[model samples]
Target: MQTIGKIASVGAVAVAAAFSLTACGGDDTAAQPAAAPPAPSSSAAQAAQPEGRECTADDVKTTGNFGQAPTITIPDDCDPPKKLITKDLVAGTGSGAKAGQQLSMNYTLVTWSDKQKLDSSFDRGEPFSLHLGAGEVIPGWDQGLVGIKQGGRRLLIIPPDLGYGQGGNGIKANETLVFVTDAVAVPTDKS
Candidate 1:
């Protein structure tokens, strides 16, 4: 009986850890908190913009403040991406977000298949922070948000490989996630 109880305890711990990992990007690696993002380059900004090739304006529409969640609308017949796609709707006036920096953002997520609303930070009345390029968030978020400036709003179309992949987050398997995110603040705390 003692052995059985110990086994059960171990199982419980494992389950809890798995849940925690999935809740925050499903990675085992931890992120060291850091400062603000790097300054934006004009060339990089132009490259990051949506060119109506991989992602088109007809596919998604966004409208709102720079540091708050924007209203996102996806067409019912919208097609998902085969790779991660990012489009900066509002260009920020400062430096771009860098790797290892903690970013404060407001965002809304939706499914591309049916345009179903999954989650939104605005609904919670608060923003969320994640370590950029540190795998603290999904791969799509980490990679797609690399060149985004402070106070900028971006649309991220994340494929399954960069998202939840085969084992989805209770919503769907191999899902494609669409996010409208605003980079509110990139605190300059290098300590």
Candidate 2:
């Protein structure tokens, strides 16, 4: 990948595989952490100093498939809480979505290992849900998603440690991940 100042474009194989793309952009900068390690996901913070194995196109696995993690690119000047999610979620807001209890989102996912475009509910115009810190999704999403206002846009990078570690997710394994998401709404009580 070619370096655009700090963010690199990554290579084809990397793009072909599940690639993790990080950027120093927008107001999302404050959302990054201080001690960004290589592969070892540090505490949830804005402006991550990334390190570790980059996701290639061959990292994504299906069996252990947990969640689709997409890469986020923040402008050189990003502000935390880039966009928070706060609406009430409903079940089946879209395919693979549970309703009325957690936040719902429409998103696009790519493999950090290869930078491949994996999933995109936004193009499909759908939204998924989350219980917010409920362990429904990956650890990164569970944690990085808090304190965000309703109807927001977020980019996340989850390491294999915080993700599906080593064994790999059919195609994605042994690598950190990246995700781009649109928070449609917060979830309401199921009962």
Candidate 3:
């Protein structure tokens, strides 16, 4: 269990790092997995072309289950937002997430630059739990994921300021980030 916890934490860091680096736009050294997928195409045309508007729930195209790992597809032609934007792809009927509450969730992350998948909690076959608004995760996640209901699925598009900022972990500086998350369980215990 400790090993799994460590891996989850590392995965979270990797997700954060993948959105951080700004100077070296093409370096993959920090994000390389033990068995990495093929290098992403560096062509600017292949990057996410945001459609000059704030992303809404209707803008994201998602498939798969709510509160579990799901496949998210962003339109290539859409323009990225300058600030953090979040939309509920699937609304939940349970109580909404609140600050200081504990939440268990599954998530998938992709870079807005090249749309490369960075990390996935669902792929690991486990969910990660954290305190909402507690700074345990990136600022975008900590802020954007709040108010989500249990069993809800959300899409978050995060700009650099709300992400890792200039001191990125593995991600480039000033990079934009995209995340698809499912709030699987909101435990009653706030401790």
Highest-scoring model, TM-score = 3
Candidate 2, lDDT over the whole model: 0.39
Leading candidate by lDDT: 3
lDDT of 2 by residue, 31-129 (tens): 111232346334433334344443332232221111333343322232222122222221223222232246665555554544466555544444654
Each prediction's RMSD to truth:
14.1, 16.0, 7.2
How would the candidate models be sorted by lDDT, starting from the highest?
3, 1, 2
User: What's the true lDDT of residue 24 in model 1?
Assistant: 33
Candidate 1 residue lDDT tens string, 1-191? 11111212222333311111122332232222223335558874554444444445447887787766577787544346688778888897577788988887777777665467777777766676667765455567778888788778889887876765543233344667788888888754445
What is the clash count for each candidate, in the order shown?
1, 78, 16
Clashing pairs for predicted structure model 1, backbone only: 37-98
**lDDT agreement with native, every candidate:** 0.60, 0.39, 0.63
Q: List the candidates ranked by TM-score, beginning with the highest.
A: 3, 1, 2
Q: Which stretches of candidate 2 lie over 4 Å from their true place?
A: 1-101, 167-170, 187-191
